[model samples]
Target: MYIPDIYKNENQEEIQNFIHENSFAILVNQTDGKLWATHIPLILDKNEAGKDILVGHVSKENPQAGSFSENAEVLAIFSGPHTYVSSSWYDHENVPTWNYLAAHIYGKVKVLNHDEAVGSLKKLVDKYEKKSKTPLRVEDLSKKTMMQACGIIAFEIEITSVEAVKKLSQNRDKKNYDNIISELENIGDLNSKQMADEMRKNK
Candidate 1:
């Protein structure tokens, strides 16, 4: 991801928070000279020592999972709320831009074995089930069944590097930023208004 110096987010805590809040991410990998992508929810794990890792799995039939070997550079993009910013809202003549928050993480991935894959499944289950009224539960799949139904790929990214961007109107004057906020707030769509609210948070 191309991030300008002004828009760069170097705060590790903030970046991790963004990833947690927007766990659904686009997983990108290089295949046979082509880029392959898949959208999936990922869990961020942090140890007591503050070391961080990422965990996720794709469907068994999804070809993207097979592209990564024991050590492959992979990127996962987690996007937060964003909206279009019209140039008309700026104080001076400026190009139209987008306001948003995102994090891109690059790391090496290793395919997990069957036993390790089972733990990954449980983590996914716990995440989705935590909010259910009945708390739907999944019993561990048999080794044979898990090996069959699950493409059963689990990989951990050591987070070799991360880049985050927060493209709000930080470069603009207060008046122009306020005007943009008011305009966004007046938008009828809920998401637009939500984006506006988010923008206002940093002001």
Candidate 2:
């Protein structure tokens, strides 16, 4: 999360959109003086007072599930596509580098009650299942199934700070940047294509 001034992106709307697009996040916290991490999908939400919140759940059996206490500090990382940029792609001599996008969110964690957990599950299902041919709705689950699902520990993080970076070769000259984009697009891989798209957007 060490973002240079040139690479830092502080646009609130853009940051929020990026989080929504890349909802899967790495949640990190410290427990018993040791670091712990979990990879999970989280939903970005807003409170009645318009404060940003992150919602997610962990299995009750997960040790991390017990780490949440009021105002516990945690970090959530939303990583986007990245690819290696060869120096050969540049018009002039240069070293190879990486082009990527990522956001780091620091927040205070809060555990949710049973009712809130149920609502969080419903929202998560709706968000991900929207594009499915036969979309699954949380309401369609049997009472027992729903109860079991809600058995997981739901939590919310109130965002305290955001640090985002878009390292899309902004330091390169226009010609070299264009070349990188062109080469990446022609690579025809998911990560390369995504890097190309991000470069184009920033360009």
State the TM-score for model 1.
0.88
Candidate 2 off by > 4 Å: none
Query: lDDT of each model, Cα atoms only?
Result: 0.81, 0.91
TM-score of each: 0.88, 0.96
1-203 per-residue lDDT for model 1 (tens digits): 89889889998888888888899999898877788898988899853467788888877677777678722889999998889889998768989988888999998786777677767777877887888887644464455655553555777777888999988888888899899899988885765787788778878
lDDT (C-alpha) at residue 191 in model 1: 59
**Strongest candidate by TM-score:** 2
* Candidate 2 lDDT tens digits, 95-118: 899988999999999888999898
Task: Spell out the clash pairs found in candidate 2.
Answer: none
Name the 10 consecutive residues with the lowest summed lDDT in model 2: 62-71
lDDT for residue 3 in candidate 1, whole number 0-100: 88
The model with the greatest lDDT is 2
Off by over 4 Å in 1: 47-50, 140-149
